[model samples]
Target: MVTGGFVVDLNKPLVSQVGHLGEAYEEWVHRPIVTKESPRFFASDVLEFLTLTVWWAVPLIWLPVVCWFVSTAVQMGFPSRQVAVTMVCGIFVWTLLEYSLHRFLFHIKTKTYWGNTMHYLLHGCHHKHPMDGLRLVFPPAATLILLMAFWSLVKLLTPPSVARAFVGGGLLGYIMYDCTHYYLHHGKPTKGISSNLKRSHMNHHFRIQDKGFGITSSFWDKVFGTLPPTNPAEKSR
Candidate 1:
């Protein structure tokens, strides 16, 4: 089925077609899904199109960068065990970072014109067009900027050895998070943890927006008291 500029497949199980409801947030979701592609702000159509679509390419692109960081640190004479431990710690730290960014930054409400525009561009677009496969994953351009910022932070805060290992693990965590998010939105999982994650994410989109902020793991949501109710009765309500 085609609506607005977006192509929707009737065979695919879409959780919601209804628009997002909120003050200053009425236009996007309510707007008809376009059957034709939306034009880009950028003059370069290829770059613009590439920015909107990201999937496996992002992780694959980052893998070499992550490896170089790790290997370079090891070459600087860091103990193998220490590097491993640091990397593990960085991965653990990523869960908190992911939860915090999704809950606070992405979900932030802005009243100003520019603020709202930026907000919509950053995340509200996702809520507005949830099934748009192209916009489902983070753009590699944006990811690179974040990587630079994070790399700088790690280097500044920790020793060179620890920084390298930390970046590697954090990169892995982010890749996993992005892949899992894409899977939950598009993949079919009849049972197990994958199924649960799909359900939780769907609920966040369609039912309880404030709760269930954790994507990589529900642990942070549980810890922060944001995990949405899971009981069958509660879900029906």
Candidate 2:
């Protein structure tokens, strides 16, 4: 039962827990949140559909931008090799950032009203509704914000030539991470790295939330001691 936007666990009784919000804990974890029907967000059907489907366009849209930035960096007096190396380092850096955000930011626990709301908005929604096809990918608005912040930070700290190459490479890495994440959720890969990633991600979603934070690569998870243990059943399959 819901009262004042909070789900009440009937057995527990609202009177027994006076100060605490009566929101059902199980609902947050197990229920599929129908975004279209939520009055709180006032989400439009068209917008929800677009956000879910925008992953297909991300590579096409960003690849050209990345290429242009790299080319412009080369023209700005940076050695081609140095630009390439810097770009590769940027990609490497993104993996760690991804892991950190997933583990620390997205999955952060909170007791306050606003903090829990923010967590649900950012990531808990995905965990609760994993098969919601439209919700699997990052929406363009959020992506643009992240990209702008990263690019600005890179530019602020480095020479223009180096910053351009770094930002371009980081963007490329981010695009790959998002795409790979979507694929792990929706694609069928029977063998090799894709299969491995898919399995680990499923484990993260269903069995263990604290482990397997890396979606694009397990290297960081291994480094941070958060890698999910290999189950014997998974090994035979």
Candidate 3:
């Protein structure tokens, strides 16, 4: 099916549609489509709108939730030091989780029609249209669902106070990620860490999708041996 000029077959695997050998598929999928607006995803206007999220909405919607988690942890008699420690740990954990999900789930090769469709909706579309501002950040509706699952998992593994603080920190990390991602795409970072991050992420989108999966920090990519080539000559090659 073609939606907003992008062809997507919901009934067949992407590999089959592009080429059986997968070489053509790789080139096609990695090629970027720059556009200001996001493509239509659902026929229903509301559903399509729900899929398009502005970068600011991420922090606006989730910041309060993070505050609530931290405040609640304090109310529950958790010491400030413990709360701080857990929250920091949560933020640290999010960086790893970010790297894992980007490298594993988002980039997973799929063979079935449903699998391909899900992958496209989840991450492929972003790759195919890397400059679509509306699609840079995760939509609030989908994020809320994931948030619940993460909350449940964390709660099960830890006490309530700890979970709350940890989740809060994770949420903060997510906020930084979304904002940084948007800025990397649209904002000019002429120097320092922001500049380096923008270059690394842009290379991931335009040069090598398999490497530099870390958005907030390239430390994980360095640790995992997935850091993209840094040599100017290598990058050109």
Candidate 4:
């Protein structure tokens, strides 16, 4: 079915329909379509709008949840030092999670109908339309679901107070990540780390999708040996 000028067949795998869209699967997925608005995902306007989010909404929605987590840990009699340390550890854990999810799940190849449809809805849409400002960040509806799952996992593995602190830190890390991701797509950072990060992410979107999966930093890409080639000539090939 066509929605917002993009074709999607719910009964057939998206990969199989690429030729009909007039591009090879790889080329169509990697070639960015510049647009100010996001494409429709649901027939219902309300449901479709729920999938599109502005970059600013990330902090506005999650900041209070982070504060609540940290404060609850403090109220549970965890020492300030312990709470602080656990929170930092949580942030560190988020970095690794970010890298792994991007490389493994978001970029996973699938040919089944549901697999391709879900993949397109989740991440492929962003790759196919890299500059769609409305879709640059994760929508709160999707994020809340993942946050609940991770919260349960953290709480299960750690003491109550520690879990709260850690989750708070991880949530902060996510906030930074989403904001950084949106900025990388739209902000002009001519120098320093921001510039480097923007270049790395742009390469991931336009040049090499399999490499440079780390959105917030390239540190993990370096650790995993997935960093994209630095030479412009090599990238162009």
Top candidate, metric TM-score: 4
Displacement of the residue 148 alpha carbon in candidate 2, Å: 1.6
In Å, residue 187's CA in model 1 sits off its true spot by 0.7
Candidate 3 residue lDDT tens string, 1-237: 443344656444342343222323344556677877566666666767777888999999999999999999999999999999999999999999999999999998864556656777788778877989998999998888878988999999999999999999999999999999999999998999999999999888887788899999999999988988987456532
Per-residue error (Å), model 1, residue 204 = 0.5
lDDT tens per residue, model 4, 51-118 = 77989999999999999999999999999999999988988999999999899999888655566666
TM-score of each: 0.81, 0.80, 0.87, 0.88
Which of candidates 1 and 4 reaches a greater TM-score?
4
lDDT of 3: 0.82
Per-model lDDT: 0.74, 0.74, 0.82, 0.83
Cα lDDT tens digits, model 2, 31-140, are 44434321122135564444454567778778898999899999999999999999999999899889999999988776555655566667866776676656666777
Clashes of each: 8, 0, 0, 0
**By descending lDDT, how would the candidates be arranged?**
4, 3, 2, 1
lDDT of 3 at 138: 95
Error of 4 at 193 (Å): 0.5
Q: Is candidate 2 or candidate 4 better by TM-score?
A: 4
Candidate 3 residues lying further than 4 Å off, grouped into runs, are: 1-26, 232-237
Show pairs that collide, candidate 1: 3-33, 4-33, 4-34, 4-35, 5-33, 5-34, 5-35, 6-34
